[model samples]
Target: MLRPILFIFVLFFFKYTYGQNEIYELRVYEMEFFKPANILHDYFEKALIPALNREGVNNVGAFEESGETLPKKIYLLISYQNMQAHQDVTDALKNDTQFKLDAQTYWETPSEKTPFKRIESIFIRSVSGFPNLDKPADDSEFFELRIYESHNEDALRRKVKMFNDSEFAIFNDVGLNTVFFGENISGNQMPCLTYLLAFKNKEEHEKAWSKFGPHPEWQRIVKLEEYKNAMNDISRIFLKPLTYSQL
Candidate 1:
């Protein structure tokens, strides 16, 4: 092998089999509060995103809650390259002096424009074995969307583990392919889990769900006391990706 290909090959074959190849998932959930909407848009554009970008945040943008007449909360799904990248990005923010200053400036500046209401943000990593995640989502076409919310921290972490652990195979076995999975971490609400499952289209999404809900393994897993108590509300919504999301 040539030097360049050999280098690339080591980066690939030696990296974990999956998400490490090209997937790093980060999802955000926000409660819809009128006072902070514009402030949020401005904050991301002017304050938060710059710091986040420096830390390797990708697909960073806010979106409205979809398929609703009167939407109550929104979410942002951000991607990274790997667990180490995710860890470094988050850890960098904690240690970054400029980020600390910017955060204070962001909150203080926003306080002048609008009042703040606390919202939850959690981050989760995606599990392997869901289909069609062979490349980065450069085109924005996806079909199955899934979100799981737990009411507390311990339970939320457990939910994250279930998706991250071997249990995630149930989704693949039932024909539900995952697009991206991550917990919310920026929007500020606590004890909530937000993730997305995208398919090729709406019909495929519906079929996937049909396969997911009634699978025999799922039935058995669903009966587990640990799974049952870990969740309080599980919400799912379909989102249409928009242009200029980086803005």
Candidate 2:
């Protein structure tokens, strides 16, 4: 009993000191050509989201590409309080009788009739500077998801530090509203950091970015020696929230 008490105390101290950073799961579903998207939508709206909310997870985000493309993509973002919460919630779902019943239609659907051809999942940990996901404004209809890939682990570390030390404030000054910023913990991109920005529309998106390039703070930080060569590549995708999206 003493050992268990000590262990619990250590865990509590760790979380309290570290600001309780959240874990984000980003799931991308690539839809089949002829399959209806509504099947997955129904499952998410009527079953998955509700079950997750009951389990104390809320503000789930569902989105799609701003433009139509082959093999349509559906993006889902779920946030967990911590690593332990993520594991516990996942295990609890397996034994959730109501969740099982609600998900019956999805479970009974034939393989060939399934909505997606494949599902890709990426897990991320919130950055120290940005410890939680923020819901976008009511008028925020456009979002940009950006991934910065570094040449190596050290470079990735520097890039993340750059964001923490100066870039986040610069972004705020320039009116580039942030939704979330995180380091990819498990995904295809090994040495990368990902972040999302929200805007009212395309024009607002363009306008906000226009300020970032010429801002005095940005100009000064971009020339900082420590951050030089911190990133080698960037991938940007524009997304729009689905009708049922919570963020």
- Which is the leading candidate under TM-score? 2
User: Over the full model, what C-alpha lDDT does candidate 2 score relative to the true structure?
Assistant: 0.91
Check candidate 2 and list the clashing pairs. none
TM-score for each model: 0.51, 0.93
lDDT of 2 by residue, 183-235 (tens): 99999988899889999999998888898899898889899899999999999
Cα-based lDDT for every prediction? 0.57, 0.91
How much RMSD separates candidate 1 from the native structure? 7.5
Q: Where does model 1 exceed 4 Å of error?
A: 1-65, 71-75, 80-147, 151-154, 165-167, 183-189, 245-247
- Top of the candidates by lDDT: 2
- After superposition, the stretches of candidate 2 with alpha carbons farther than 4 Å from their true spots are 1-18
**RMSD in order of candidates:** 7.5, 2.7
